[model samples]
Target chain A: MVVYGVALLAACYLIGVIAGDALGALIGVQANVGGVGIAMLLLLLVSNSTSIKLQLGEATASGITFWSAMYIPIVIAMAAKQNVVAAVSSGWMAVVAGTLAVLVSFALIPVLSRLGRGAPKV
Target chain B: MALDTLFDSLVELLARNGLITAFLFVGLVLALSNWLSKVVTRGQVHGSAVAIAAGLVLAYFGGVATGGSKGLADVGLFAGVGLLGGAMFRDFAIVATAYGADLGALRQAGWVGALSVVIGVVLSFVVGAAVAVAFGFTDPIAVTTIGAGAATYIVGPVTGTALGASSDVVALSVAAGLTKSILVMIGTPLVAKRIGLDNAHSALIYGGLMGTTSGVAAGLAATDPKLVPYGAMTATFYTGVGCLLGPSVLYFLVAAIL
Candidate 1:
């Protein structure tokens, strides 16, 4: 059952990758466009569908949940692969760009918060 | 002589199946990180944050030891780490996070949350690109890549790879994104009350604007456990938004400017 979930994810991933490439070609970008995002949308659609949900059963659903929580480890693997020292040594641009972006974004949080103040409560 | 042969065979076997070895090694790192988070930091910082820091350190040493570009994966025993941390699995893992989201809940966040996502991406891009210019990066590709990195780490590399930026530039974008993530993780709770990040509505907006799921999630967990899901929801969408916009519209915009 767990394997079924993995199979489903693999299917979504493949489709997402294909669609992303197609989109990139269509736009003349020469690269996959939002493959991860497309795959996520596909997964959300398949899992939330009532008919597919019935077929998935509890075991398969738990498998998906298990992998979803695997984000932490996957992220760790990603971090480990990055060359932080080289990036830092390349120039000051990386550090400056990152810090400035975050600081500006953080400062704007209050302004954005105010924009939503008048919305109706759900 | 017999014991030496046994050890060599064991090493060869692990080298042959690097993925399994990588999984085991990462598990150890995470186990240690979680412990450190609990004991040393007293849970003030999330375990994943600590784990990432450790990972970066290990990667630095791995490169120094092997003189290779792929970091620890360049070592024979951990070769599977290359595939495990490669684009395929990274995208797969990111997509899987959408499993827990409820579509209905997203709709409840309203137009404000959606607005925040767009504004967040644009604002971060502009700021990052400006800083890149100030630092003398004249190339549009480099500017766009770093700008996208400010949107999120995922967006940075995706844009870089798509645009054919050099490895060093891509690495810089990653560093930029990582810095943003760590900052958001540490700063969220400290400024949560001051920024009025108390309710699910505000959390949704915050997530959209911040655009780093891990940072927003961990920060909200420290602020209020119930708000993590709400913040993470929009933060997930923020990545999607950034990925779509980064290499296309954002790239073109930077090209026009510089």
Candidate 2:
């Protein structure tokens, strides 16, 4: 039963990758398009549409939920890893921009916070 | 199965491929960070915050060890990390998270929420471009690439590749975006109280201001999971806006200035 759930995810992922790549090709970029987003959307559509028609068992449903929740931490870690690598080899300017963005956001917080308080309903 | 059990199975598969190894590394990092957060920060800090820091440190070592473009890919066992963490999954995560967002909540954030996304993207671009100039990057492509990267990691590379900027410049932009994401993740919880980042409404504004979806989502998850969708909803648009502006209006402005 859970096998059916994972199969759904795997199919979505495959379609997502293809769709993303096609979009990238259309846009003239050489990378994968919104594969993850496409996959998630596909999953959402399939799960929602199939719920009424198909009797997805508890084990199957839980499998889908488990993978969905895991998406964030896993992706972020991978992205962070790539980012760290790019920053290290890209020379000082890249490092500077990265470092400076963090510093600037920190400094901007107080100013933005005050500006955001125009209508504090709470 | 429970999360602990999931991690148990995941860690054993680390050597299987890039995706599995990537998952293993992330799980290990989260576990370690959660432990640190509880023991050291007394739970003041979020586990994702610590995990990102640990991830970056390991990434650095991976790059050093393999001398490869992809940090973990340089190492044999971690090579699949390149695919696991690539744009496809990144965009999918964003899309999936955004789908969970409710459109009705947009009213709570109001016009201020809308304005923040625009202001945040432009402001970040300006800051990034200024840094590029200060560092003696006189070329428009380099400046624009870096500036776009400041907007969001996704926007940065997209703009760079579109404008024919060198790989190095594009890479820098991604780094710039990543740094912002990491900072947002770690800083949100600490500043949530002071900035009124508690409600669904305020979370939208916070997301608009931050703009990086992953950063805002992780940060909001740390601050309050209920607000993640709200913040991420607007944050998604921030990326779209950044993509629109990065290669066109912003690039022209930087070119003129340079």
Best by TM-score: 1
lDDT tens per residue, model 2, B1-258: 699998866654665656776677667767888999999999877776677566657777877877665665556666666666664565444444433344445554557777877888888898899998898889999999999898788889989988999987887888888777766766777778876777766777677778887677667766776676567656755776677678888988988877
**How does residue A9 of candidate 2 score in lDDT?**
67
**Candidate 1 error regions (>4 Å):** A113-117, A120-122, B1-8, B136-258
| Native-referenced Cα lDDT, model 1 | 0.76
Q: Which candidate is the best by DockQ?
A: 1
In the range B1-258, model 1's lDDT, one tens digit per residue, is 999999999999999988999899889988999899999999986776677677767767777888776667777888887777776776676566667566665566668888888999999989888888888899999999989988888888889998999988887788788677656755777787788888777887888889876566546654665565566656756766787789999999999978
User: Model 2: clashing residue pairs?
Assistant: A20-A33, A36-B92, A37-B91, A37-B92, B18-B80, B18-B81
* Two-chain complex of model 2, DockQ on C-alpha atoms against the true structure: 0.28
Interface RMSD of 1: 3.8
Local accuracy of candidate 1 as per-residue lDDT tens digits, A95-117: 77777776787777778777776
Cα-based lDDT for every prediction: 0.76, 0.69
